[model samples]
Target: MNTKFGCCLIIGSFVPQTEGKDMETDKVKQLQAGLQLLEENGYDFAELTVQFLTQLSEEEFQQAKKIIQQSSLNIPVCNSFIPPQLKVVGPTVSIIELDDYLDLAMRRVREIGGEQIIFGSGGARTIPVGFSKKQGYEQIKQFLCRCESYAVKYGITIAIEPLNKLESNIINTVEEAISLAEEVNLPHIKVLADSYHMDLENESFTILKRAIKDEWLSHVHISDRERRFPGEVEGKEAMNFSKLFLILQEANYRGLISSECNAASLVDENALSLQFVKRTWSTVEGGIANVKPD
Candidate 1:
């Protein structure tokens, strides 16, 4: 495994999509155990859902923070920035409440030592029917600009994630996200490249190379085609991560690569996925992936 690259262990139980169904007792234990598993298997950091983490009351936040600190793994990145009900762009939206919500989320993230937040909330950012795409684009730019303000206060960066078209109608590619980042033009705003979305969008790594060279790539999420742990993909069909890893290394990208996949066996799959990712990330060591700028 390349020491420069970092992996973010994203356990299923900690994710927001599953937050409501499970019992409180089971949830806490699973979260702690998953963190322990990641640390025991060589992962340095993990990603948490900002929305869910911020939903905790003050006391819960303190207790949760204690468990995380005790686990010895850092949380440098956060996912699920906005909740589904927040209409971020339409006329029926409540901008003030949304801003407050985002600020609260960032505050919680700052408290937990999170350095980056993923803006991949497909439902929140979606353009409503009958609205012009151009209008939606402008609104997104303004939204990100406001997000940058809050992010700056917490010493955090908002990583613009390009969701695939199926999940989002606007900003569906890294190229578009880069354009938005440039438009926002704030140091606290950046971009991310998720391999799963890239595959779904048919985005070639050639485009990602540009993000790396320009230093716009802030974080990454790696999952197999079926959204499973990389090596856990059965049969001969598997995504070729070697080129992507090489591109990231060649660009000298020192960002977090969180596993945002479905893990049937959290402990076992986390280790297996890490090992597979490490091997793939190692294929181009000392080559272009390891080049240093003069």
Candidate 2:
């Protein structure tokens, strides 16, 4: 499959935030500790959040950058592209604010050696009550265009993530995400397929075939229902992940498949999820389009 596996660090669980010099110290300490854990556990890269990267102070950013530069694990993909405060849709849409944030965010992403950022900011992109859905789509398209400008400058790709309707009011399907990405029609704008959301929406794995065909699928995020780490669900509760991996393998997906989930026990779950993903993917064989649940 030529796939590289990684895990997302839920920073809040691992790193405690503080104030003044202590904040910088905490951030650096957190980065060091997190990266060490990933590397020790055999992760190819680390998936971080743009929120975490952009919120850093100059000193903090520098310290964190040095830590990243020295770490064996690469930070190639980042999620949580926009925070709730930075609204990307609705009547309150602000190009100026969006531009300003992207300006700094893309630079930080590039500085930290990030190749792509997942656009899955549900809070920021949700259509407000009374706001026309049509208008919201236009707003999102405009936002992506703005993102494309910054992305091109920094050699970054923007992966438009389709959230489950529970998490977002718009772009809830892979087809919709790909459509929006196509509408944007920019080189740096693409799509991301998230297995957690797909399962939540009961979206078929066949959608990935179309995404792969169009080269719109740039990254992947995976987790079981209830946002548990992979392999946590078993028996009747288990998701047919083999089908998804087999589809991806047949399509020759060479991008990263990151575990994006909430775990009660981050340390142990991270290792467990990574092992699960590798072991599951190892069982995927070519020429088998249909995978039956075991």
Candidate 3:
């Protein structure tokens, strides 16, 4: 695949594995169902949450791994890297805890053949009240530096995800993500572009073009304006996925693109969304105009 297309397996809202055995079993079953749907619908991979795998017990972790290993689709990408309790920033941050979390998270992701992990833990990275944005920025940069070491050790790439202001205080745009990733200056650390967040911020897709040009983009996430599945809307309310794919085509972006959104039905919604994206992509060609946010 020139540009791999996939979707985040939201399944059920992630419940901590410690919550209960029934919930744990439900999650595993949901994973099995979701993976089957993705493979059946022709998805290239499935995006899972890093927190889910990291929190699993040894046996549960092995079970989850087995489920993924048996699937036709690869779990090449994961999001929700750090949980809110981990504290990637702020004065209360603990280096020891962060290190331990990163060690386990990186190892687990690599074990499942994950190539990139999206760092979009808004709560974990948010600047606390009275905390200096400057300091928080530095803290995040330092955190990414720590992550780079783990990435190198595990042979996985870390994609710095830029959330919208409502979702995060820092790194609210692709430009900011690119700058941070550049300053970090590690081969294992790269940037990601999320269309939903970009629309929320009204950021121009032209910046994604720049990200592609500068080789800062490592992965992408797509959703409509309301955080609905990519194909949920059309015409005026629709996200111009064709333009987005055209940008990728023009720039020769060979990275992964996953839809991260909400939907009423996992099977129906994902299959429809997958078909919509594939249909739109099939019709796109070069010479399209720059994407200006509506």
Candidate 4:
């Protein structure tokens, strides 16, 4: 297999057991360990979640940045922002105030030597239950445009992810995200596709393939039907990913596919999941290696 076509990224969610114990000390160590594992196993990059940095103080963020800069790993850090609230609201930060948070977050990313930052289109909490789809879409479009303005300053591209209907009623499909991105009309704003959400919506891979507009697809997230490791679960569910990869290859998409699944409960089990993902990528690329380059 051509190793260049096998580039994939592993996210913190994939290795749930190994992170956030001390929050301050263990966070950086766990990220470094994950990056090492990715390099040793042949992956090209490791996606990082910024919520890990939210665990540290401003000064601690600087210290963590220094450590990341000093590492020998070639992994590129892709940043992700968790919604303001977890399960329920304690003290919520409004979307209107998100720019301030984004400013701080982007500064931290630059200080930490990261290039890309991923953001979610407003969550379920942003809209009331009785809100109309038309109204919800309008609000999301406004927020995305505002975010794009800030994103352009950092020379950072924001991959706006659309969560599943179960997670958020607004922006539940790729079409919706693409439409919003078009409305924003900014070079720095784009869409991200997550296989987990695609499964939840029962959306066809063909439909997703046709919907993707060039340059709009900035990133991808992959996982199996149950949000488990790739290749662990067999049958039609696992086979669907092959089709997804084929579409990506046909389009000549060249971006990171971050494995964002909760693969296992232990660090060792998660390591196995990472290995499984690499093997699957090899198989997928082998089948399409003959395609002519564009």
Candidate 5:
């Protein structure tokens, strides 16, 4: 399997994470800066949030797509597909409005060569108070199907990302994501296994094995327990990519595994974090090479 790697541009930053302060850079400059750092650090592609497309108008989106096309590296997958401030499962949700937004987003994402769009906007999907669980589930299903309509037209797949409970009330596990995809029964709908969310939920690699066997896994998001880059935190808190990579390699998985995490700072040490991820993967791949074919 040609297991490629990428990092999320929206969540990853050159500046340290801080509260009450959002770092805003134009998409062109952001892509230029991130692609340079990631390419130097041995990354294969860059991931951007669909928020960048949603934030722009028709003309602006065209220009943004141009910028992405001109980037030194490919933006293969765009995460955070939903509009940031829009809710999909609440009394306040306007499904019609959201549907329109999804259509526009899919068109732009298709133009920009993003094959997969990650649906992991915790803020957008969280069921608000007073909404029963049943209502929330039905609403989310409908919302995803609507997105799939656009996806089919624009030639893209939607990877349903299961966030931890703190971030999302629905679809918090690989099983749940699979169930949702099965229920929706859309060819363009798929599942993503995010390591941080899986760890927070106390879910096991066993589920990932199941997902792989069923071919439900479309993409992967890897990070340490604290949402820092994988392999950065060592000792007791280390992210065990060894077993996960073995599962992926044994299954012959060929999909994008992205670093949707933050670094302490994106200075010189950022390259080290990216290298740590590559080295860990290389070690696991080496182990796989020693295993005799059954």
Candidate 6:
């Protein structure tokens, strides 16, 4: 399998060096820092959180794109975080109004020359706290279909990410995400597997390996057990990554594997996390290389 490395820009990586004054300026600085880190680590791509990108003005967004372009990196994926309010069905049915948002988001991706949009499954309150499993499945299917329509227009793919139960009750497992993608019946809509959420859900790596189809597995988010730098966790690390890498190889997955996790408290520890990812990816590549020809 071809192993690719990427990172997600969030609080720690992107927030500027201000003691905590104007959040906007701080965010730009943080993003700039993140770009530098990606360059230093030799990451091939970077995925920006939608929350941060949405806050940027056109010029700011262009500036970010220019910086990234000038770097030794390529911005291939942009994951949009659907705010909690937008997902709920309250007075603001923003969740239902995804068409416009998707159009704008896709346009931005095109403007910045990105390939995929990672869609967060609906938020906690979008469905009733005690909503039936069937109802949840149907709502997700509908949402994915809507996203698919927008994706088709811009030649961009939509990757559905299943958060852990703590983050979201709906679509909390790779199985759930796969089921929804299948139900949506759109070639452009695919599943995204994040290691952090998988750990939270206590899902077995084998299950994810078997569940992801070659075409449906669109993206990957890499993080350790504690959502920290990779080496911080121990035990069967190689085994877990080996399973995923082998499966991806068999499935012929060519998407980006992004390091998506909180790094705020680990600001000083960024290099460690970045190094860990590179090393882990090297291990994965080595394993793939050793696979004997049938």
TM-score of 6: 0.83
Off by over 4 Å in 2: 12-19, 286-294
Q: How well does each candidate superpose onto the true structure, as a TM-score? A: 0.90, 0.93, 0.94, 0.80, 0.90, 0.83
Candidate that would win on TM-score:
3
Give candidates' CA RMSD values in order: 3.2, 3.4, 3.6, 4.7, 3.8, 3.9
lDDT (Cα atoms) of all candidates against the true structure: 0.79, 0.86, 0.86, 0.62, 0.79, 0.68
User: What is the alpha-carbon lDDT of model 1 when measured against the actual structure?
Assistant: 0.79
Q: lDDT for model 6, on a 0 to 1 scale?
A: 0.68
On residues 1-294, what C-alpha lDDT tens digit does candidate 6 reach at each position?
256778777642222224533666666677777778777766677787665665566766777667666766767788754655455333334653566666777777766677888876355235665556676566567666776777778888888888887766677888877877777778888888887887788876655555554367778887776676565667765226656656666566666788776666445665676677666556776877798999
lDDT of 3 by residue, 55-150 (tens): 677888899999999999999999988888789889999999999999999999999999889999998999998999999999999998899899
lDDT at residue 100 of model 6 (Cα atoms): 66
Give the per-residue lDDT of model 1 (tens digit) for 1-294: 435334444433234443543444454565677777778877768787786576666766677788888878888888888877887777777889888888898998888888899998899889999998888888888888888889889999999999998989999899999998888888989999989999999998788788888879888888888787788886667888888877777677777788787656565587878888887777666465456879
Query: How many backbone clashes are present in model 6?
Result: 3
Which sections of candidate 6 miss by over 4 Å? Answer: 11-22, 88-97, 121-126, 130-133, 211-214, 235-239, 250-252, 265-267, 287-294
Give the worst 10-residue stretch by lDDT in candidate 4.
5-14
Clashes of each: 0, 0, 0, 0, 0, 3
Candidate 5 has an lDDT of 0.79
Q: Summarize candidate 2's per-residue lDDT along 237-282 as a digit string, tens digits.
A: 9888888898898887877888888846568788877888888887
Better of 3 and 5 by TM-score: 3
Local distance difference test, candidate 3? 0.86
At residue 49, candidate 6 shows an lDDT of 65
Which 10-residue window of candidate 5 scores lowest in summed lDDT?
12-21
Model 3 residue runs over 4 Å out of place are: 11-17, 286-294
